[model samples]
Target: MTNIAELRKQINYHLYRYYALDDPIISDAEFDQLMQTLRDLEAQNPELITPDSPTQRVGAEPLESFDKVTHVVAMTSLANAFNDEDMRNWLGRIERRLPTWYPRDAVEFVVEPKIDGLAVAIVYEQGLLKQGATRGNGLVGENITANVRTIKSVPLRIPATPDGPPPPTRIEIRGEVYMPIKEFNRYNQQQLDLGERVFANPRNAAAGSLRQLDSRETASRPLAMFGYGVGYIEGAELQTHWDALEYLKAVGFPVNPDIIRTKNFDEVLEFIRQWMDKRDELGYDADGAVIKINDLTLQKYLGLVGNAPRWAIAYKFPAREATTKLLEIRCNVGRTGQVTPYAVLEAVNIGGVTVRQATLHNFEDLAKKDIRPGDTVLLKRAGDVIPQVVKPILEARAADSMPYQPPTHCPDCHEALSHFGEEVALFCINAACPAQLVRQLEYFVSRPALNIEGFGVKISEQVAQAGLIHDVADIYTLTKTQLLSLEGFAEKKADKILAMIDESKHQPFDRVLTGLGIRYVGSVVAAFIAHAFADIQALQQATQPELEQINGIGPRIAESIVDWFSRPANRTLVQKLRQAGVTLSSSKVEPTAPQTLANLTFVITGTLPTWGREEAAAFIQDHGGKVTGTVSKKTDYLVAGEAAGSKLEKAQTLNIPIIDEAGLKKLATE
Candidate 1:
C-alpha cells in the first residue's frame, strides 16, 4: 500500500515553504514528478487517498454551491499618500511610534511595489490548495476556488521530500490578482471586437474577471497573481513578511522579486522613487509602494485601526500625472460611425510614457469636461486604458483660452453628422468613408474576427485606397496574384492572406454578426440573437420587444439593432456582404432533435476528471437540457465532480437529483 499519509505530510510542508516562505530550492519539473508519483501511488491504493491527501486536492465530488467563508483576520485597505509631503508625514508618524514599541536603535522597513489589482486569498490544507476567495469587505468573500486553480502560478499541491517532515496542516496566502499589460491589451481588443465596453484599466479588469459568476468565464481570461502576505498558518512559524514571501516561492508560487528589505527610511524612499521612474518597465502595474515593519511580533503590537494597519503604510507616488497644453482637438470617425474627439497635446510624460495625444471619448464628453485647445490639462495613462485628460488645470488656463467645439461633418468623408434621438454621439452616415472602410477591413481580418492571416494594417489600407476592397465583402474579389503586387507582401504571404479570406467565408453566422461592427451588438449578444432569430431577415425584422425578451439583451440593445438596420447605408453594406457569398443565415434550418432531455435542468460543480466544464455543459445543452448557474429546487440534476462544495449540500437539502459523469453519460445515451 502507498504511504499516503507520509506523502501528504511531506507535500504539505514544502507547499507552506513555497507559498508562505518563497524559498523554493527545487525545480518545477522535480516537484511535478514527486506529485505524479504520489498520485500514481494513491491510484493503486485507492483507500489511501484521504481527504487531506495531495492526490485528493481536486476529486470526484461536485459542488452544489460554494459556502461563504469569513476571514479570521480581516483584510484591510491602505491609506494613500499623494505627494512628497504626504510621504514625509507618514514616515514621521511611523518613526514616532516605533521608539515607544521596540528597543531597537533604528527601525527597518521593507518596501515593496503596491500592485494595483484585485486582492484575493488562497487557503491550503496539508499543502493542497483547498479554497480561494475574494477580499469582500475584509470580513467575508465569495469563494472562487475553481478560477484560482486556473492560475498557473498558483501551485496545486505543495512539494514533499521522500523522507522529509510533513507540511503545515493549514496555511493561507494573500495576493493581488492582475493582468499584464500585454494580456490586458489583447483582452480589451477582443472585447472591442465583440462590441463589449472596454475595461478602463487592468485593476478593473482583474476585479471584474475574478467576480464573474461563472468560474469558467473567469478562467478563460489571462489572469495572474502573486502571493504577498500570509493570512493564516499552522505547524510553521514565520518571523517577517519577507520570510513568508520566500517560503511561498520555495514551494512553487511566483513572488515578486522587487520586494526589498531595507534598514533605513531613506533607502525605502529611494526604492520608491526608482520604481516610480520605471513603473511601466515592470510587467504589472504598480500605483505605489508598501512599507511594512519587518518583525511580525512588532506588527501585531501595532495592530489595526479602522481599515489600515499601523505596522504598514503605503507611500503612493504622485499619480502618474502631467500637465500639457492641448494644441488641437480633432474628431475621428470610427468604423461604427461614432465621431470620437482626440486632443493633440504638447508632449508630456504620464505614467512613464511620453503622451502626445489623448482620447476625449466623444463630442459630448468634450463638452462635459469643458476641454479646449490652448488650455493646460491634467493627463493620465491608467493601466492599459487609453491616455486621457483627467481634468483641466483651471488655475493654469490663459485668459484667452476658449472651449473646444466639435466638427459639424465627418473628418474622413466630410459627411454631415447626425445625432440619435437619445444618444450623445453624432455619427457619420456614410458607409464607404475611407477611414471607416479601412478600420472595418482591419477588424474583419483580425485574428478573432475573420482571421485573414496575412492581411495587415498597411495592406488593408492599400487595398482600400486602390478600390480593390471597399468593404469586408470585397476581400473575396482579390486574387493571390493581385495581393502579391502590394508593397512589402511576398508571394507566400499573399497566398496565406487569400487562403485566410477563403477560410473566413465558412465562419459561423454569429462571428459574421460580430464582424459587422454593429453598435451595442457584441459577441455574446450576437450569439444570443443568432440562436434566437435564426436568420438575417428574421433578426432584421425583430421588434424591439421581441429582442428585449432574451435573457441578456435589454432595451438599449434592441434600439441599437433597430437603428443599425434602419440606416440605408448599413442595409447597402449588408447587401454587399451577401453578394460576396458569405453565409448570412443560420445553417441550422432544423433544430437538432430533443434527446429525451427537453425539460431537464443540471447544475455542475467542481472539476470533472475526464472532460472540461465547457465540454460537460455542451453535452447537457446538446441533449435539450438547460445548464443553470446555481443549484435550486428546479434543477433536475447536480453533476458532482472532484472538489465539490456547498452546491452539493444545497442539492441534498432541496432533494434534487445528483449524478456523476458516468451516470450523466448513461442519462444522455438513454
Candidate 2:
C-alpha cells in the first residue's frame, strides 16, 4: 500500500534538486530505487495515475504527427546587432520612439545570453503545465507537450512555496530548449560507438531530440530549458521585465542566473565582452546576448517593427556557423597511409576567419553526410578548433547532384588504395610512396611521437623533396654537409635539428611504437604492448592469440599487430632503429598490480580535481577495471566529477553506483 501522491512529490523534489539546483542529497541509485517503488505502486493502481505524475511523462505509444498550436500573442524574433555601433543605432531608434517623459539614460535593460537552441512556448493553466509548442512560425507551432513533459527542469505542476506567489489563472512562458555541451558530447560519442549518424553540433542534437515522435525517445535525451520572456499572462500584474522574470522563477520556472538588469549601456557592453570570452566555459551554447527594455511600459511604447520588437535587440558574437558551397572534395594521405576526404569551400567567413577548407573526416563520414560538390553546406568553427562541414543543405542542393565516389587510387602517389578488415578508411599500402615518406617523417618527428623540435611539416617536406630523407629511418643518417645544401639550412639551424634528432634516440619504446604509426597502435595501445613484451624483438615474435590475451586488445587490433610485424619491410625498419642506438624497452618496469576491479566497468564523466579523464582511466585499467564511453545496465559504477551530465542521469536511472574522484582513489588502493 504505497502512497502514490507522496512518492510523486518526493521524486519531483529530487528532480528539482538534480536539474534546477545542481545538487542532490542522495545518490542516483537511491533515487532510482525510490522511483521504481513509486512506478510499481502506480502500475498496481492505474486508476490513481494523473497527467502531472512523474511516471506519466513518457507515453507507451508514439505520436503519428504533432497537432498544431496557435499562440494568443505572436512569438517574434529579435533584430540583430553585430557591433556596438549597431547596438547604439538600435538604442537610438528606441529612444526616439519612446514618450518624451521617459528618460534616455534611465532606461533599464535586461540582458541575457541568447541560447543557441530551439525556441519553445509553454502554456500553464492554474499553475499546471498544459501545453508546449515550438515557434514554428510567429503564430502557429507543432504541439510538443508530451515531449516537453519529459524534461526534468520543466515543472509539471507549480507548487506555492513560502516566498512565492500563488498559481496564476493562465500564463505563457517562452524559453529556449537546449542540450548542454557535455551531454551533447556524450550522446555523440555513443552514436559513434554504435556506428550511427551523429549530430553535427549541440543545436542540431537538441532540435532533433525535442522533435522525436516517440515520447520515450525524447525522455532519453538530456534536454533542459531556461525561461526568457512571456507570450501572455493573466491574473498577474508584472510592471517590468525583470519583475516578470522574478515572478516566473518564483513560480517554479527555470530562469538563467546570469541574467542582469543594468541602466548603463557601458555595463551592458562589459557584460557582452565577459560572456564572449567565457561562452565555452558555460554548460550550454550561447550565440549572442539579448538586450531588452526592462520597463513593460517602455516596451509597449516602442512597439513592433516588421517581425521584431523595436525595444529589444540581439547583439550577436562572431558567426560560429555559416552556409557555403562545397567547390570540390579532395583526399589526402596521412603518415599512417590512411586517406582522408576534405571539402574545398567557396571561401566563407566564420568567426571573423575565412574558411577555405574543412575536413570530411573519412569516406564513410563523407558518404554518411552525403555532401556532394556544388551543394550548399553548413560550415562550423568553434573558437580556435578546425572548421568542419556539418552537413549539406539538401533543399538548396543542385537537382542533378550525385553521390561522391572515393578514389580507387591514392590522390598524391597514384598507388592503389585498399581497406583493412572492418576499417572505414581506405589506405595506400606503398611504404616507399613519396607522399607517404614525407607524412611518415613528419609524424616520426612530431611532439607526441619523438618530441623533435624544428622538424615541422614544411621542413619534413623540404628534406624529403631534396632526397636527404627517404624514410623515417633515413632521418638519423643525414649529415651536416647534406643539410647545409638545403635552402634554409644555416649552420646553427642544422646543428639544432641534428641535436633534436639525437635527443629523440633516448625516447621510450612505447613512443617509438607510436612514432612508427602502425595501424590500431596509438599511445595507449603502445603502452599496453610495451608493458606486456620485454622488447621490440619479443613483441615482433608474439602470436595473434598472445596479443589478444592482453586487455583492450581485441581481435581486430591483434590481427593488425600480427600483420604489421609479419611485414619484411617493417622488420627491416625495426632493425635499422635498433642499429641507430634507439631505446627498445621501458627503463622503469614493475610487476603487474593485483586485479581488484577485474570484472567492473566504469564510465567517467566531467572534470576531476587532480586527474584528467585519460589519466584516471589509465589508473583504472592498471588496477584491472574496464573503462567504457557510455553508461548502461552493465556499468558497475559512474566516476562522476564536476558538472557530470547525461551519463550521470542515465547511471542514476539504471541504479548504478556513482563515485567521485576520491572514491575512485579509495577503490584503487583497496
**Which prediction has the highest TM-score against the true structure?**
1
Model 2, stretches more than 4 Å misplaced? 160-163, 321-378, 383-386, 390-403, 407-670
Q: Cα lDDT of model 1 overall?
A: 0.75
Quantify how close model 2 is to the true structure by its C-alpha RMSD in Å. 11.5
Instruction: Kindly report which residue stretches of model 1 are placed more than 4 angstroms away from their true locations once superposed.
Output: 1-109, 117-227, 230-239, 242-278, 301-310, 313-319, 349-353, 363-365, 382-385, 418-421, 479-500, 506-513, 519-670
The TM-score values for the models, in the order shown, are 0.60, 0.57
For residue 344, give model 2's deviation from the true position in Å.
9.2
- Of candidate 2, the 10-residue stretch with the lowest lDDT total is 189-198
- Counting only residues 3 or more apart in sequence or on different chains, how many pairs clash (N, Cα, C under 3 Å) in candidate 1? 33
lDDT of 2 by residue, 1-670 (tens): 5578888888877777777667777899999888876765664466787888877776447899999999899999889999999988987887777788987788998999988999999998998899999998978999999899998888888752224587889999999999988887777544433223456667887899889989888997889999888888898788999998888777667789999999998899889989988887778888889999999988998889998998899999887889999999998777667777789999988766799998786688788889899999999875333578989999997889999999999988898999866767688888777888897788788876887989899989988989887668888888899899988889999999999889999998889988887766767788877655546776787788666766568787888889888888888888888888887755433237666776677888876889977677767766666676667777899999875767788999999999999999888788
Candidate 1, run of 10 with poorest lDDT:
54-63
- Backbone clash pairs for candidate 2 read none
